[model samples]
Target: MVLCELKQQLDELLALSDGYAYCNQEVGRLACVQGQQEAELTALHTSIEAQNQKLLASTLARVQKEGAIRKGLEQHQQKLVAQDGQAEVLKQQLAASNLARESLSTTVTTALKKLALATSTQAQRVDSVEERLASLVERQRECEVQPPPGWATYLERNAVSLVALAVAVFTLGLNLLG
Candidate 1:
């Protein structure tokens, strides 16, 4: 009986040592799994930080592009305003030119009408002077053969006066024509 008890105790101690070794191996496997999980989490954090940096660079480039676009738009707006002002000035100049053209047309018309009236008056005066000159020439030719007397001298003086009047009339007609 004493030998049997001693064998049983030894078997129990061996079974306990086996249980402890199995528990220690399981603990070591659990520690390795936890280390792998930590490494994966660290890699994920590094990837997230790199993505954030890329996003920041992209955002800064977008902001700069937007600022340039805004400046370009402002410059375009200023050019449009200047063009509009120039257009208004051109419109005013056109209106003034049209008014000047109309005024010149009216002046030309008035001058033409006045010239026509003056031409007609000059024509009537020329006709009347020509008729009077024809009559005086006939009287002077009849007096050329008459005998000398006091009345004949007066008639000769009258012939000289008629010649002077004809010369005056011719000079006035030439002036009116020019």
Candidate 2:
């Protein structure tokens, strides 16, 4: 009975040792799995950071391009505004030119009317003077044989003065026409 008791205790001690060794092997396997998980997590973090940097760069480029486009649009708007101002000024100038042209045309028309009236008056005067000259010539021929009457001599002198006056009027009319 004593030998059997010793054999049983030895068997129990051997079984406990085997259980402890299995527990240690399980702990080592779990630690290896934890290490693999940590490496994968670190790789994922690095990938996320790289993607974030690329996204940030793309956003910055987009913002810069948008700003440039906005600035160009503003400049174009300013130019359009300036051109509108110039167009307004040109319109005003055109209106002023039209007014001036109308005024000048009215003045020219009035002057032409006065000139026509004056020309008609001058032509009538010239025709009356020519008739008087023809009558004076007929009277001079009729009195040629009657000779030295005092009235006849005075009438010849008056006829010479009238001829000079008619020549002066003709020269003035020519000057006005030219």
lDDT of 1 by residue, 1-178 (tens): 4347546655665665576566556555655655665576567557655755665575567557556655655565566567875555555545665565567556556755755675565556556555655554555444444433344444464566557667878999999998
Candidate 2: misplaced stretches above 4 Å?
Answer: 1-4, 83-178
Q: What's the true lDDT of residue 43 in model 1?
A: 72
Q: Candidate 2 has which clashing residue pairs, if any?
A: none
- What C-alpha lDDT do the candidate models reach, one value each? 0.59, 0.59
What is the TM-score of candidate 2?
A: 0.41
Q: What C-alpha RMSD separates each model from the true structure?
A: 73.2, 72.7
lDDT of 2 by residue, 97-120 (tens): 556556755655675575567557
* Reference-based lDDT, residue 132, model 1: 52
* TM-score list, all predictions: 0.41, 0.41
